[model samples]
Target: MKVEDFDMFCTLLRQRSGLVLTSDKAYLLESRLMPVARKWTLKSLDELAVAVRSKRDEALLRDITEAMTTNESSFFRDQKPFDQFKQVVLPHLLANRAAKKQIRVWSAACSSGQEAYSLAMLLQEEGARLAGWRIEILGTDLSSEMVNKARAGLYTQFEVQRGLPITHLVKYFKQMGDKWQLNDDIRGKVQYREYNLLSDLTPLGQFDVIFCRNVLIYFDQPTKSKVLEAMAKLLPPDGILYLGGAETVLGITEKFKPMEGQRGLYTLAAK
Candidate 1:
C-alpha cells in the first residue's frame, strides 16, 4: 500500500474501532486486511483503500475493522485470573450477593467464547453451592462472526486442548466426530453478543465481575483512559475487573486501583 493510503486505512480503523496503528504496524494491517481485500475482489490493499474511500460502505468498514481486531483467546488464556476468580473474587461475591442469590460476569472482548465458557465451567463446579442461585455469564466481541461461533459452542481438538484440563474436558464436552462440542448445560450458561467496547456499555447492565483482558493494548492513551472510565461506571463499588497482565489502570485513569495483593485484578477506586 502507498504511504498515504496506509495512513488513511489506519485512521479509518481508529475512528471505527479505536485501534491504534503505528507506521511499524503497516505490515500487520496489510496482513490482516489482505483477506478482506480478496473477498471484495480488490486487486491490492491500495485498491481496497480506494474502494473504502469511494463507497464508505458500513458493512465493508465493519468487516475490515473486525478482521483487524485480534481474536486470540484460550479456555483460560492465563492461569492466574481463573485462580483469582475461584479463590477470591467468586467467594467474596457469593457471600455478598447471598441476599439476591444472583451473580453476573462479563467477558468483554471474549474472542471465541473460551474465557466465558471457562467461567461457566467454574460455576458448574460450584453448582451445588449455587443450586438456587441465578448465574449469568455474558461474552461480547466486536466481531459478529466470533459471537456466532461462541454461541455455537463448538471447538476443534486443538482449541479444546488449550488450557482445558483433561478431567474437565471429559466431564463437560462430547466428541462430535473429530471436533468437541460443549454440552448444552454449560453452553446455555453464557450469552454472546457482538458489541464494540468503545460504544455505550450501559445497556449490558452492571456486572459483578468483568474480564476485559488483553484488549486495551491497541488503543492510544486517551482511548485507554476513556474505556477505563466507562468500565468504572458499569462496576459497583465492590465489582472486580480483570485486565491483561500487560495492561494497567495506573497512569491512565483514576477510576480503578490494583487489588492489594492480586496481580492483574482491580476494583473501583474510592471517591
Candidate 2:
C-alpha cells in the first residue's frame, strides 16, 4: 500500500476502535485485510484504502474494523485465571453474596465465547452447590459473527480440543457429525452480545466479577486508562476484575489494585 493510504487506514482504525497501528505493524494491514479487500472486490490493500478514503462506506469500514480486531481465544485459556476463579474468586464471592444468592459475571471482549463457556462449565460442575442461586454470564464482543457462534455453542474438533479436558468434553459435549456442540444446559447459562469496550458499559448493569482479559493490549495507554475507568464504575466495592497476564493497573487507573497472591486479579481500591 502507498504511504499516504497506509496512514489513512491507520487513522481510520484508531478513530473507530482505539487501536494503535504503528508503521512496524503495517504488514498486518496487508495480511489481515487482503480477504476484506477481495470480499469488497478491491484488487489490493491500496485499493481498499482508496475506497475507504474516497467514500463513506460504513459497511466496508465496519468489516475492516472487525477484521482488524483480535479474536484469539480458547477454553480455559492461560489456566491460572480459571484456577484463581475456581479456587479463590468463586469461593470468596459465594461466601460474600450468600445472602443474595446471585452472581453476575461479565466476560468483556469475550471473543467467540470460550471464556464465558469455560465459566459456565465450572459453574455446572458445582451445580449442587448453586442449586437455588441465580447466575448470569454475559459475554460481549465487537464482532457479531463471534457473538452468533458463541450463542450457537458449536465448535470444531480442534476448538474443543484446546485446553478442554477429555473428561469434561465427554461429559458436556455431544459430537454432531463433525463439530462438537455443548449441552443445552451449559449453553443456556451464558448470554452473548456485541459490545464495544469504548462505549457505555453502565447499560450492562453491575457485576460481581469481570474478565476483560487480553484486549486492552491493543489500545493506547490513554484508551486503556479510559476503558479501565469505565469498567471500574460497573463494579461494586468488592467486585473483581481479571485482566490478561501482560496487563496491569499500576500505570493505568487508581480505581483498582492487584489482589494479593492472585494472578491477573484486581479489586476496587480502598477509600
Candidate 3:
C-alpha cells in the first residue's frame, strides 16, 4: 500500500476504534485486512485502502475497523488479578455493600468472556456469601463478534487449557463434542454487550470494580485519558480499577490512586 493510503487507513482506525498504528504496523494491517479484502473480492490491500477512503460507505469502514481490532484472549488470563479479586477486592466489596446486598463489576474490553466467567466462578465459590447479593458482572467489547462469542460461552480444549485451572474446568464446563461448554449456571452470571470505549457509557450504568486490562496500550494518549476519565465517572469513589501490568493511572489521570498493597490495582481517591 502507498504511504499516503496507509496513513489514511491508520487515521481512520485511530478515529473509529482508538487503535494507533504506525508505518511499521503495515504488515499487521495487511495480515488482518487480507481476509476482509478477499471477502469483498478486492484485488489487494491498496484496493481495500481506496474503498476505505471513499468514506461514503459506513458499513465498509466498520468492517475495516472491526477487522483490525484484536480479539485474542483466554480464560483467567494472568491469574494474579483474579487471585487478588478473590482474596482482597471481593471481601472488601462484600463487606462494604453488605447493607445493599449487591455488587457490580464491569469487565471493559472483555474479549471472549473469560475474565467475567472467572469472576463468576470466584463468586460461586463464595456460595452463601453472595446468596442474597445482587451480583451484576457486565462484560463489554468494541467488537460485536467478540461479544457474541462471549455470550455463547463455548471454548475449545486449547482455549480452556490456557490460564484456567484444571479443577474449575472440570467442575464448571461440560464436554460438547471436542469443546467445552461453560455450564449455564456459571454462564448466566455475566451479561455481555457491545460497547466502544471511545463512546459514551451512560447506558451501561456504574460498577464497584472495572477490569480494563491490556487494551489501552493500543490507544493514543488522548483516547486513553478520555476513556480513563469516563471510567472514573462510572466508578464509585472507592471502586477498584484493575489495569494491565504495563498500564497505569499515572500520567493519565489523578482521579485514581494506586492501592498500597495491590500492584496493578487502583482505587478512586477520597476527595
Candidate 4:
C-alpha cells in the first residue's frame, strides 16, 4: 500500500472507531483487511482502500471500520480485577448503598459478553445477600456484531476454556451440542447494547462501576483522556473504575484515584 493510502485508512479508522493506527501497522492492516476484501468480492486490499477513499459508499466505510475493530476477549480475563470486585468493591457498595439496594455496572467495550457474564456468575454466587437488590449489568461494544453475539451467550469449547472456572462452568452453562450456552437466567441478567466510547454516553445512563479494561491502549492520548473524562462524568462520586493492568488514569485524568490494595481499581474522586 502507498504511504498516503495507509494514512487515509488510519485517519478513517480514527474518525469511525477512535482507533489510532500508524504507518508501521501496514502489515496488521493488510492481514486484517485482506479477508474483508475477499468477503466483498474485491480483487485486493488496494481495491478495498480505493472503495474507502471514494467517499461515495457510506456502507463500505462502515464495513471497513467493523473489520478493523479488534474483538478478542475471554471469560474472567486477568482474574484479579473480578476478585477485587467481589472481595472489596462489592462489599463496600453493598454497605454504603444498603438503603437503595441497587448496583449498576457497565462493562464498556465488552466484547462477546464474557466479562459481563463472568460478573453475573459472581453476583449469582452471592445468593440470599443479593435477593432484594436490583443488579443492572450493562455490556456495550462499538461493534454491533459483538453486541449480537453477547446477547446470544453461546461459546465454543475453546472459548469456554479460556479463564472460565470449571465449577462455575458446570453450574451455569448447559451443553448445547458441541457448544456451551450460558444459563438463561445468568444471560438475562446483562443488557447488551451497541455503544461507541468516542461518542455520546448520555443515552446509556450512569453506573456505580465501569469496567473498561484493555481498550484505551488502542487510542491516542487525546482520545484516552476524552474517554476517561466521559467515564468520570457517568460515574457516581464514589463509583469504581476498573482498567486493564497496563492502563491508568495517573497521567490522563485526576477524576479517579487508585485504590491501595486493588491493582487496577480506581475510585471516582469526590468533587
Candidate 5:
C-alpha cells in the first residue's frame, strides 16, 4: 500500500470509530479490508482507499469501519466479571433499589450478545428474588451485522463450547442442526441496538451497570478517556462499570474508582 493510502485509512478509522490503526498493523487492516475491496469491485486496498478518500461514499465508509472493527466475543467471557456481577453487584442493587424495583444493564460494544445473554441467564437464576422487579438488558454494537446476529440469538457449536457450561447450554439453548439458538425467555430478556460509542450516549438513557469489555483497547488514550467519561455520565454513584481485564480507568478519568478486590469492577467516585 502507498504511504498516503495507509495514512488516509488510519485517519478514517480513528475519526469514524475511534479505532487507532497503527502502522505496525497495516497488514492486518489490508487483509481484513480485502474482502470489502472485492465487495466494492475494487482491485486492491489501494484502489479502495483512493475511492473512499476521493468519493467519500458513506456506505462504503461504513463497510470499511465494520470490516476493521473487531467483533471477538464468547459467552460468559472472563468468568470473574460474571461472578462479581452475581456475588457483588446484583446483591447491592437488589438491596438498594427495592422501592423502585428497576434495574438496567448495558453491554456496550456487545459483539454477539453473549455478555448480555449471560447476564440474563444469571437473572433467570435469581428468578424468585427478581420476580416482581423490572430488569432490562440492552446490548449495542457499532456493526449492524453483529447487532442482527445478536438479535437472532444463534451460536455455532464452537461458539457455544467457548466459556459456556454444559448445564447452562442444555437449560437455555435448543440445538438447531449445527447451531444452538437460545430460548425465547432468555433471548427476550435482552435487546440489541446498532449504536456507536463515539456519539452522544444520553439518548440511550441511564444504565445501572455497564459491561464495556475488550473494546477500549483499540482506542487511543484520549479516545479512551472520552468514552469512559461519557459512560460515567450515564451511571449513578452506586452503578458499576465492568471493563476488560486489561482496561482500566486509572489515569484515564476521575469519574470512577476501582471496586476493592475486584479486578475489572469500577464504581463512580464520590463527588
Candidate 6:
C-alpha cells in the first residue's frame, strides 16, 4: 500500500471504529485487510482503498472496519474480572437491587458471546439466590458476524479450551460432533446486538454492571475518554465498570475512579 493509501485506510478505521492505527501497526492492518480485499475481489489493499473512496459501499466499509476490530475472546478471560464480578460486584448488586429484583449486565465489545455466556454461567451458579429476579446480559459488538456467532452459541474445541474450566464446560455445554453447543438455558440469558460504541448509547438503556475489558487499549486518548464518559452516563451511581488488566480510567476520564483495593474494578467517581 502507498503511504497515502495507508493513511487513508488508517483514517477510515478511526472514523468507522475509533481505532487509532499508527504507522508501526501498518503491517498489522495490511495483514488483516488482505482477506477482506480478496473477499471483495480487489487485487491489492490500495485498490480496496480506491473502491472504498469511490464507491463508499456500505458493505465494503463495514467489512474493512470489522476485519480490523474483530478480536479474540474466550470464556473466563483474565480470571480476576469474573472472580471479582462474582465476589465483589454481584454481592453489591444483590443488596442494592433487591427492591427492583432485576439486573442488567452489558458485555461491551462482546466477541462471539463468550464473555456474556461466561457471566450467564456464573449467574447460573447463583441458583436459588436469584430465582425470582430478572437477569439480563446484553452483548454488543461492532461486528455483526460476531454477534450472529454469539447468537449461534456454538464453540469449537479450541475456543472452549481457552480459559474455560472443565467443570463449567461439562455443566453448560453439550458435545455436538467436533463442536460444543451451549445449552439454550444459558444462551437465552444473554442478548447480542451489532452496535458501535462511538454512537449514541442511549438506545441501549442503562446497565447495572458493564464488562468493557480489553477494548479501549486500541483507542487513542480522546476516543477512550469519549467512550468512558459515554459509559459513565449509562451507569448508575453504584454502577461498576470492569476494564481489561492493561486498561485503566485514570488520566482518561473523571467519570470513574478505581476501587482502592481492586485492580480493574471501577465505580463512578464522586461528583
lDDT by candidate, in order shown: 0.92, 0.92, 0.89, 0.90, 0.93, 0.93
Runs in model 6 lying further than 4 Å from the true structure = none
Q: Which structure is stronger by lDDT: 3 or 5?
A: 5
Please, what are the lDDT tens digits per residue for candidate 6 over residues 107-175? 999989999999999999998889899999999999999999999999999999999999998999999
Question: What are the clashing pairs of model 4?
Answer: none
Winner on TM-score (1 vs 2): 1
| Per-model TM-score on C-alpha atoms | 0.98, 0.97, 0.97, 0.97, 0.98, 0.98
Instruction: Tell me the tens digit of each residue's lDDT in model 2 across 128-246.
Output: 98889999999999888889999999999999999998998999999999999999999999999899888888999999999999988899999999999999999999999999999
Q: What residue runs in model 4 are displaced by over 4 Å at the alpha carbon?
A: none
**Model 5 ranges with Cα > 4 A deviation:** none
Q: How many angstroms is residue 59 displaced in model 2 relative to the true structure, after the best TM-score fit?
A: 1.0
Full candidate order by lDDT, most accurate first: 5, 6, 1, 2, 4, 3
Ranking 1 against 3 by lDDT, winner: 1
lDDT of 4: 0.90
lDDT score for residue 180 of model 5: 98
Q: Write the per-residue lDDT of candidate 3 for residues 11-77, one digit (tens) a residue.
A: 8899999999988899998898888889888989888888776744877787888899988788788
lDDT of 1 at 223: 93
* Model 5 lDDT tens row, 22-93: 779989888999999999999999889789978999999999999999999998898989999989999999
User: What does candidate 4's lDDT look like per residue over 220-268, in tens digits?
Assistant: 9889999999988888888899999999888888788998878889988
Looking at candidate 4, the ten consecutive residues that score lowest on lDDT are 52-61
- Per candidate, the number of residue pairs that clash is 0, 0, 0, 0, 0, 0
Task: Report the poorest 10 consecutive residues by lDDT, candidate 2.
Answer: 47-56
